[model samples]
Target chain A: MTSTATSGTTSPEPRGPRSPGRPRSERAEKAIIEATLELLGEHGYAALAIEAIAAKAGVGKTTIYRRWPNKEELVLDALAATSVPLGELPGTSLRDDLIACVEYVRRSRGSRSTRLFPLMMLEGLNNPRLRERYETVVLEPRREVLRGVLRRGIEAGELPPDFDVDLGVALIVGPILYLTKVWNVPDDQLPDDVAARIVDSVLDGIRARR
Target chain B: MTSTATSGTTSPEPRGPRSPGRPRSERAEKAIIEATLELLGEHGYAALAIEAIAAKAGVGKTTIYRRWPNKEELVLDALAATSVPLGELPGTSLRDDLIACVEYVRRSRGSRSTRLFPLMMLEGLNNPRLRERYETVVLEPRREVLRGVLRRGIEAGELPPDFDVDLGVALIVGPILYLTKVWNVPDDQLPDDVAARIVDSVLDGIRARR
Candidate 1:
């Protein structure tokens, strides 16, 4: 496996023979992550139990415990593995990049993992440890990706140098989240060009006039 | 007592000796509502139990049942009783009124009931009945209040006649919610002038400059 290949510095033939247990362990890990996500979507964070996850994954509790110390870490891994990365931006223009980010959010509305986001937030309200991990592991990375785009906009003189990047992120992200999470606007009901509309509206307010 | 007064059309004197059951029933109702809010804050919606609420309130389950048909309705009442209505707008300018609306949201940050909003939203995701009731009972009223403000702004020619009020509301409300709910920005960390900042930012985008 990749793990063995990366770890074997002195091995003459890294790919010669896979360990008998390696493939089964990898399958178990995937099953565990899938079960974690399914339970979270059905029940939510507080009600999620490690034993239940083991049962659903058809693995022993010790296998799950060996992989993740607790439910939070397991959940964090599941989210990280499943989350759609921002991917390569077109580098065309600020408006295009912003539209891409919003479109990413719009597309996530259909996924079960995306639906668990609010439940995770609810649990984070009470658990500081999980909250910190979630921020650093899941949320901050996504925000940084968007921040990079905004930074490019500023450097290129597409936006004012004094533009607040954090506020800009909130402005672009907030309305769509409100529509999907709070308003529970159905997918079919959402405008096809919502990403463009939001990006343009925010761009008009933030972009400096020539 | 108001219920008694409103229903006593045949009574010669509406203020005559109060029904003994009425005052005690009112007190029981108050206790139940308090317990509901407390448990909801502590455990969230999915974990909330009517039996537990009754136990906490020092009343029988039947007492709670008599007043509210189910946990959702009880929660709706508890939220309604505690929710801060947008009392009256200044009607001075679109900028001022929007600031007031945003300020209202800012002030709600300190309330326990306000904290339960995300939990309620999480529950609403799965339960269509609860979602509809929450929208009609709690969310719609607040949206309507903000909607009224936007309507006035359009009428006063401060905004374009074609202004998208729903979109305007989403733009103004979304960032603030994102800051408080998603980012979990602490109260002290949030600027005192956040309301003004958000309103001005959104107004600049939506309002038609002369």
Candidate 2:
């Protein structure tokens, strides 16, 4: 968890006014992020308060404020911490490439992520700043991996030359979002066959023998 | 909207309340619902408060509480108010039936609904109460309309009897939600072609030219 960076700098002396230090306590930062995610899941974004987060983390208000400019920024950092990183692009066929992403989401079901994500989305409604961070940290990184897979597909000519990269990205991401958000697929029953099914259906279409 | 029904009240004037000759004002009820929708659009659910809504509508807290039990319920009521009622089963083809639903959703964009729908989705994150209401109020009604259309198509032999109805429903709703939620399709540009393409793809799979 980037311990080298933390260990590189001697943990700073408590600063007066400006609060001099080698950045802040890495332990305190980790604790604060965990507390923020817990608070978000438990109380939701509307009820989540910075003072409560600081108190829960056993850090001062200034410590919390110094690290993150606003509650949204704090929440953004917390969300980034809890988010499941995009798994390595699977080195198999198109099927395996797709499975990697779906499995990654399936494994995240019971975690704080399930609850925190929607709250972050809710917060995004009013907070432009939160929306920006969400796009940058969680969303863009995921899209990049998907884009790589598409680039490979097009190069291999497995998919049509003119296949819409962006559309394919949506087609891949859409069913999972539909499953999690609207359909509320049960935790155990998330279809492992889903990615294969989507690729099949999207590439092939459902029409029967003429 | 339907104030009396939305309030969940036996009578407009409560037995516990004093001096209720004129009872509650329907004007105030409509105003409050309108204000809630407006604020939800302007500030979203997290920033939307009963107090803010009351101030906008020139009503007291008691008035809002009397009509709805809580913020969740109040939001649901306002959402229901804006939702285009899922009309009766269309006697047309499944494609036409789906087109009708898409058109209704498209027309609702930029009204109170486009803004409020996302908030309802956000609320469904952790609140089982809200989730149940979401399925019943928002998700099921729309899904059922599509389901019925598919059911009829199966019965009429237009579609295969063993065709996956649930998946068919997914096909219909999936792209629309993905379009709005992630892709940020312009409010005016619902892309009827996308809806048509989705319908064609779902019914006829996307195999390469013979």
A1-210, model 1: which lDDT tens digit per residue?
122223423324333334566888779888998999999888778789988999999998877766566777789878877887667887899989999898888777766667777778778778878888888777888889899999999999888888778888988998888887788778778778877877777776554232
State which candidate has the highest lDDT: 1
lDDT per model, in order?
0.78, 0.67
Chain A TM-scores of all predicted models: 0.82, 0.77
- For model 1, give the interface RMSD: 2.4
lDDT over C-alpha atoms for residue B48 of model 2: 84
lDDT of 1 by residue, B17-109 (tens): 445668886788789989999999887787899999999999988667655667877899788778876678887888888888888877787
Give the TM-scores of the predictions, in the order they appear. Answer: 0.84, 0.74
Off by over 4 Å in 1: A1-24, A208-210, B1-25, B42-49, B60-63, B207-210
Tell me the TM-score for chain B of model 1: 0.81
Candidate 2 reaches a DockQ of 0.34
The reply for model 2, stretches above 4 Å from the true place, is: A1-25, A41-52, A60-73, A188-192, A206-210, B1-29, B35-75, B84-92, B103-109, B185-192, B206-210
RMSD of each candidate relative to the true structure: 5.6, 6.6
Q: By TM-score, who's the top model here?
A: 1
What local lDDT score does residue B43 receive in model 1, on the 0 to 100 scale?
78
